[model samples]
Target: MSTTIPGPVLQEADWHRLLLLRATRPDVVARAYAERRRPGRLLSERGTMFLLAADHPARGALTVGGDALAMSDRRSLLARIVAALEHPDVDGVLGTPDVVEELLLLGALDGKVVIGSMNRGGLDGATWTMDDRFTAYDAAQLAACRLDGGKMLLRMDDRDPATATTIESCAQAVSELAQQGLMAMVEPLPYQRREDGSLVLCKNTRDLARAVTVASGLGTTSAYTWLKLPACDEPEVVFGATTLPCVVLGGVPGPDPEQDLRSWGRSLTHPAVRGLVVGRALLYPADGDVKASVDAAARVLRAVQPSARV
Candidate 1:
């Protein structure tokens, strides 16, 4: 099943009203968070999901391929997100506090699995980029807001001491979320600093394996920790490092959508992988048809795991 994107369901005036509401009565947003209905489970009968990820912009990493500021326009970005959420196959969203709260007030999150992004302190390209701090929602905040879980980015760079602080923070977050009976979705990236001082993810399977192992051992317990991972070479080997439930994250979509879908399909066949947590690829496809892109992805997922309940 896939959802269709409606044409201009919201207008400029709607956006203005949303902003005005935030400015005039922030308490309404608080009430919305407290009272909004939530989904019964993160996954339906499918046991898998297709969550739209919008947390990248929070870390100041907004460029999509050659476009330097593809996600800088808030109004446009939110519109695209709303379109994706309307799709039946798209289960929910993962975003920072501000974005998620806006969606909350808009009534776009009802019955959806809303995952709050837990950290955004590691701004892109900064000298201290690896020192990812918990500057956003914490476990208590998420629980108060009635969110299902929190997602944290834990990039481990063996050469960078900042990695130590990030590891500790993530461990604390995992333990706290477990105490709340919430899912702790952690993305463990194998990081390396280039000569130009930019942090890049190392896609080597061996490196990802090490990251998976480290992330798995975090916190007091692993019962509630789920790994949001990249689909790398020899995925079975990379995912074999842990037993936690895994979701393959989408990076920028390549020129060939079919090829990308094939890659995601192959990865989903792995026993550990539960679903897709995609962003730009589905939200901003090359053809600019949000519904088509989302439908294609849904088709890929359905084809790969035809036995899935959803």
Candidate 2:
């Protein structure tokens, strides 16, 4: 990681400041981590959260639609993220350590609800992708960093023996995070192994509902667990399976951004859905205007969610 002052937000003097601080003051990151401010309440009276997701690159899954390396450029990605954060409705961001630390240094994370992504070793298109390894923040690490929560990718495939191990790991993480009084945002997506041995997420209403119940029941205590689910058709069927608060996730970008937003809007009508955590679709949109795309999504959020007393 070159210590260039991460985004377009920095002036020339800031670059020098960054390099010098990195070379002479290695303790700065720890200090920054220790000193980053939090929003105090995870879900304010607005009653819904709109988080930008930036943890994809760590999984070696950077392609946004047709572009193979849409997120490979750190400068561009950080700039887009900073732009998205400028929106008033945007509650926070979820990312791996590298991205989070960079934003922290750039002062882009103050008073935000930061969620640390917990697993990344299960690279995209890998033969063993289902067993997803926990390579990023653990429960203790999240607690020390004072992050609001930890997110785990749970792709449950009945055919894969590795699913058991991943489930056990996620269960422990959920329990540990709960003990620390932190949110455990678990993405419990149902997966199916094809005849060719490739695993694919089963997006049907039934499978998704099953995954939700399974995820909601993880750990000794479900008090601190939240489900990150797909914004599927029949949101009631999928979301009705659990009483746990759910956040709909944006998957790969579709050709039509407006269509995607409409689908997400429908899901928000379901009472169980609290908000959305969108990534490529919101960050790297088809129109290539990150801020406009973010604002559009924000509008969808504001339009659908009922007004609550703050």
Candidate 3:
């Protein structure tokens, strides 16, 4: 089962309208949020959420596979997203304020689950990448916009003192968002610096599991918390660390798409996993077909476990 997603085809004139609105009627963003149609429930009847992730560019990590500037083009990115949203199986989207507002103004997000990306100050390849500051939507802003939830990234590196501050901020965000009856998504990954000082995600299963456990216990309460985790080898080794609902995130794409799809399949079947929140591997596939990659992932979610996670 695959979907044929059309190539990006947003008109320059259509996009100019968005640009014009941003300059002249900037206040209309408030009205768009007020008038947008929201979903009746967060989860589908099958008990799953298949959301597209468009929050990467805000973090200065715009590379997609070998293309370092792939996401730098906003028009192409928006067009791909709009096409993907045309698929009924796509639940909603998780993005920063600018991307979300563009969709709202373009009428691309209706009856969708919109989750605002909370922290993105940790630019790619930055020396202080471990700090992960809250530079985007705050809890109050999410509530004001009527967004369904807020998502934050937590990268823990024992060597970096900045990690401690990030943990505190994420904990605060979780407590505040939960208090408003909104969902709080936390992506906790273990990090380590190479001999050359380049930061790399620690793929060790035990370290990954430890990261998950640590994030699971964050904030004053975990009532409305969900985790965005990577689907790695021995899914149990990482996912078994927490009972919180988890969504497998699609990071960079591998040379073989089949291998990536299989990895996702393994994680989607886990008892702890709720659904998928994929990005690049789907949006900017090596083949440039966003629909096929997203559809393949959606099928995995359907074929795996469709039982309740919330």
The candidate that wins on TM-score is 3
Worst 10-residue lDDT window for candidate 2 reads 1-10
Q: Report lDDT per candidate.
A: 0.86, 0.86, 0.88
List per-candidate RMSD values in Å.
3.8, 3.2, 3.4
**Whose TM-score is higher: candidate 1's or candidate 2's?**
1
- Candidates ranked by TM-score, best first? 3, 1, 2
* Candidate 2, position 196, lDDT: 88
Which residue pairs of candidate 1 clash? Answer: 3-88, 46-309, 46-310
**TM-score of decoy 2:** 0.93
Higher-ranked by lDDT: 2 or 3: 3
For model 1, the run of ten residues with the poorest summed lDDT:
1-10
Q: Against the correct fold, how does model 1 do in TM-score?
A: 0.94
Candidate 3 structure quality by residue, lDDT tens digits, 202-268 = 8789988999999999888999999998888978879988889899998777888889889988888
Can you write out model 2's per-residue Cα lDDT over 183-223, one digit (the tens) per residue? Answer: 99999989888888777778999999999988988998999
Best by lDDT: 3
- Quote the positional error of residue 215 for candidate 2 in Å: 0.5
Work out the TM-score per prediction.
Answer: 0.94, 0.93, 0.95
Q: How big is the RMSD of model 3?
A: 3.4
